[model samples]
Each structure stands twice: as C-alpha cells, then as structure tokens.
Target: MSAPRRPVLAGNWKMNHGPSDTARFFADFLNRLAPADDRSVVFFPPAISFAAAREALQGRPDVRLGVQNVHWEASGAFTGELSVAMAKDAGAELVLVGHSERRHVFGETSDETAKKVRAVLDGGLVPVLCVGETLDERNAGRAEAVVAEQLAPVLSIIRPDEVAELVVAYEPVWAIGTGVTATPGDAASMHHAVRERLAQAFGREAADAVPVLYGGSVKPDNAAELMSQPGVDGVLVGGASLDPGGFAAICGAAG
Candidate 1:
C-alpha cells in the first residue's frame, strides 16, 4: 500500500499581518512549534509578506509558505494582481484557490478557480482548493451538490497522479469568521462526500490520497477533535491561526 497521507495544518492569514508582523509571528510560532515529521504545517501569508515569512522559515524547510491567491496567467496587463510565476518568485510553494471570500466578496467563479488550479500546477506549485456551501445552501440540503459543482471543473482538468499535489479545504461560508463551527460530524460528512466526488473523478486510490481539510472557525480547543474525524486529514485555520501560540497548538493537534 502507498504511505498514508500526511496531515496538513494550514494557516490562512488572510488580509491581516504585514511583513514585520509576519516576521514576528513566525519568530514566536517557530519557537512554540516542535519539529515533527508526522505532519505538514503551511502558512498562507499575504503576498507582501512572503519575503519576511521565507526569511523566518529559512532553516525549517518542513514548514512551507503559500500564497493566498494567484492569477491564472503567467504575465498580464492586469494591475495589482500577481501571476503564478510572480507568486513562485515570491517563494510560495502552494496557492489557495476558490476561497469563499474570493467567491462571495470578490465574485471569483469555479471556472476561474479551475484555471488558477491548472496554472499553479503547471507552475509546479500545489493547489489548496477550497470548496464549501453557504448557510442557505446547507440549510436547503444542497451543500454536497454545491461542493460537487465546485470540484467538478477542477477535477476534470487534473490527472489522477496530480491529486498528490492537491489539497481540498472545506470552509463553510457561514462558519468562516462568524464564530460558528460545524460539528466534527458535519465536517466529516462533507469531507466524505468530497472524497467520494474525487473518487468518481480520479478513482478511489487517488481520492484516498488527497488530503481533505476542514476549515471555518477552527480553534486550538476543538482542533484535535476536528482532525480526529474520519476523512478529516487536517484543518485550514483563519483567525485562530493569527495567534502564534494558538496556531502552534492547533498544529500539534494534527498529530
């Protein structure tokens, strides 16, 4: 059998943390974090702070740095947007695609996500594809369908072996930044559905190799339980991750 997939604890700093703050955050975080080979820990800082994060993570190659977003094109007339090559130049090893805020707040579409996924892959960067439903969709019992729709296009563009370079993060819009978290069972159920969808697209073996993460209001206190659920390979942290100590504790829970 192939080796078990490693748990990934990813922190999405979002719009917070400037370069100096990024440096300070990692200084404290790395101090608190004990080196372990059992899991992976990644930080998705803002594009501007990539340098500081990379410098802070100099000796620790196991802790990776990622870009919050990347444009599909290698170069463009588009201003204020960084392309995949630019992101790679900025030292990002992973790119977040289709985050809920990118969709709801900025109107990013699934097709756009698919393109970005392809670009990141071609650029030799991993894509942490975020998929989930809003509160209303979940209430209507259309959560799984919505997630499927989000994944279908991207799945079509990726080969089965490429699944190894992909990570799926389920971040319910209602739960994100609302202080409301889905119960472990709820997250696991959605993760299972996501894995099933991947199985259909890439076969069961490839699907099982993908690391499906549960996000949205995940905290140090509940992180262990969330990661314990079946199909929950890890977590995508937001506000709770802004705190160095708290994020370290959350990473510890991934074990």
Candidate 2:
C-alpha cells in the first residue's frame, strides 16, 4: 500500500563459504548484477570471510557487508567471540543480532540479543535484529505471541529514535530452510503485528520507518510477491543465496 518499504535483499552465508569461496561468489555476483539504487543489498558472510567480503565488495557502493554475529563488549577475555568494535574494524557496516541459529542452537536468550543490539547501536553499526516463531509455535497458533516474546526485551531497552536505527527481520523457523514459506497473507500479518508492537513500545514514526524483513526460503519466484505485501520490507535469503545466479535473480526482482 505504501509502495512497499525500500527493498533490502540480504544473503546469510551461515557457516558456509570460506574467504576464497566468498571471493569467488562475489566475483560472479558482481558481474551478473544489474545496477540499481532502489534496493539495499547486504552480504552476511561468515566471521572468517569478513576480510574477503570487504575486499571483494570495496568501492561497490551498491553492496554492503554485514557480519552474522558480534559480541556485546568492545573487547574481552572471551575466546572465539568477535567484539562489536572488531566487526566495525572488519569493514562490516551492519550486524545480525539474535539470528534463529544463534537463539536455537547456541541457547541465546532475548536478553542477550538485546545486549548485542544495544552494543551494535552504540558502536554505530546498524543492527538487524532477527525475530521469529518456530514450527511448533505456529502450529499451536502462538506465532504472534512467540514473536512478541522474542522481541519484547529488546524493544523494552531501546528508545523510539533507537528503534529507527534498527531493522527487524521476521524469519519463521519452519520456513528457514525446509523450503516452506509463509503465504503472503501470513508474512504480512506478522509484519503488521510487529508494527503494532513497535508503535506501542516506541511510536508511530519509528514503527513506520523501521524496516520489517521476511526471511525464510525466499527465492526469485516468490520475492516480488512477498515484498509487495504491506509491512513486508525485504528478505533475508538463506540456501538460495549460495548460488550467485540465484541470488542475483532475487535481488533483481527485489530491485
């Protein structure tokens, strides 16, 4: 209805694609890209490929780099953890907080995600806070409740202005890689609920401006329709993103 929010097509490599593979992916992707300024594109490479992503994407204003995750502290005694400052230093302009894998596999809580979100914002890096419901939750008709639960702590901590600085991704666990996608109506409903929640916690302005992305089995065939729905801003692509051609097609449709 509002011309759909500016399209943001992001790829989450997720534990796949090393630096060399990452470079190769970008090499092929860059060549296939049709220049367009209407859409926002981001590459969420694995932590190990940050440097390679930066190198490949440098001087390419149309594409930006985002890291899959970042530790809340600037520096710490923590091992195997990357700090927010380190993400910035690695040429990442954005960071994903509370991704589904991070929440389900690593047992990360919403409170922890809130801490990372705050740190990312404070460190001047945009945070794409991932929120979603699981298969069981959806079957139980608790999808909306689950989303609010996952997002509440984070929303409770940030101000209206701060909310404007963040992007909320609605990635249902059931649809992530099972090749199942929520119908357009389903995705739109969740995004609308997200907006209502935002309006309650922050304000109308923040709710309107904050992009609510849908992630999960998003492909070229369905991208345009999903993106066209009200309150559905963009997509966070998973498996389809592994192939440069497939990903490019999705971006093209999004654009």
Candidate 3:
C-alpha cells in the first residue's frame, strides 16, 4: 500500500477577520472540535491577525498557522508587500501562492507566483500553490490545459525534493465564492490530472507524496464527499472557512 497523504483542511479567512476575530475563532473551534491527530488544519488568516493567531493557537501543535500571501523578496522597498521573512518573523509556517484572488485581482502572474513558491520553500515554509480553470476555459474543454499552463512555471522552478512539500489546490474559478462547487467526481478528475502532470515532471513516488487539495465553495454539507473522492487530498476553504464551527466540521470530514 502507498503512504497516505495527510489531509489538509485549510481555512482561508480572506480579508474578513480582525485580530480579535482570529482569537475568538480559535477559542471556539478548539472547544468544538478536539482536532484530528492525523490531518493538518491550517489557519490562513490575513497578515494583520498572524500575531493574534499565534498567541491564540499556542500549545495546539495539532493546528498549523499560515498566511494568505507573501512577497518573493526578502526585504526591500517593496511598499505594501509582506515578504517571506516578515511572514516567518510573524510566525507563519506556510504561505499561499497563486491563489485566484492574487491571480485575478492583484494581477499576479505565473512567473511571480513561481518566485513566491520558491521563496517560501527556500525559507523552510510549505507553499500551497493554487491552480485552476476559468469558466470559459472549462467550457472550451481547456480545463486541463489551463491548469497545466498555470502550474508549469512553478513546477519548473521547484526542485524535485521540494515537490512533496507542495500543496496544489485545484479551485475552479466559476465555483469560488459563487455558491457553486465542482462535483466530487469533477474535482477528483481534475486532481487526477494534476497528479499525472506531477508524476510526469517529478516521477510517481514524489507525485503521490504531494497533496492536491480541492477548493472553491467547499462547505460542511459537501466537504465529506469531496475529500472522500479519490486523489483529493483535502480542501482549501473560503467563505465557509470564516465560521469556526463550519471550518472545524469540514476538518472533521477530512479525517
């Protein structure tokens, strides 16, 4: 039998929570769920709440801390940007790159995403690299193509040994924040394709070791089904993640 991929149920609390909110969420979540011992339930709070998160989540080794975004540069005059060094200093152990919001809203290109991925890995932090297809592309039967294109640059930059540390979130653009979810079968198919691509690039052993998560409108109602699908290692939750109880419930499904 192959080694199991530890499920990662990540809460991407984007621009929604303050420091107080972060503290409150954990306090409630820890009370509701005892946290699965075998999975990674990461909290990707906005940068402003990292300090509060670190404080609130202390002593809970079962919970991992992450940040929504990070700059590739270590330190410079990149105004309004938080570098990996800054994130590390602020107690972030994982960082997200290529999130759809960073791609579409902030105009972060694949090359820039690649830079961030490399920085995070080199800095000893894990990188959750998001990749996906737009509605039009999926309708055109270019879903796989789009995912490949988006991931190509980052894969090219990362070393083979670092492959296992990467988490690829297959988020369909149309489904994100739109209350629509890619059916479990559909998400599994995409995840299979992603694994095939990784195998081609880094060989099967390394590929199988990497966790490919499904994102985009994942909720408690559907989290179990999605995570149960073959090749779907976990979930990268958005809106539903804001609710501590809801997110904890999703984490429960992952195990």
What C-alpha lDDT do the candidate models reach, one value each? 0.92, 0.89, 0.90
* Model 2 residue-pair collision total: 0
Q: Which candidate wins on lDDT?
A: 1
Q: Write the per-residue lDDT of candidate 1 for residues 14-118, one digit (tens) a residue.
A: 999999999999889999997888898999998888898999999898899899998898896988888989888778889999999999999999999999999
RMSD to the true structure for each prediction, in A, is 1.3, 2.0, 1.5
Residue-level lDDT tens digits of model 2 in 1-255: 122357889999999999999999989999999667788899899998889988988778889989999889888799999998988888888999999999999999999999999999999999999999999999999999999998898998886667768889999999999999999999999999999999898778768888889999998899999988988889999999989999999998874
Ranking by TM-score: 1, 3, 2
Q: Count the backbone clashes (under 3 Å) in each candidate.
A: 0, 0, 0
Q: Which pairs of residues collide in candidate 1?
A: none
- In candidate 1, stretches whose alpha carbon ends up further than 4 angstroms from where it belongs are 1-3
lDDT tens per residue, model 3, 1-26: 12478898898989988998888888
TM-score of each: 0.98, 0.96, 0.97
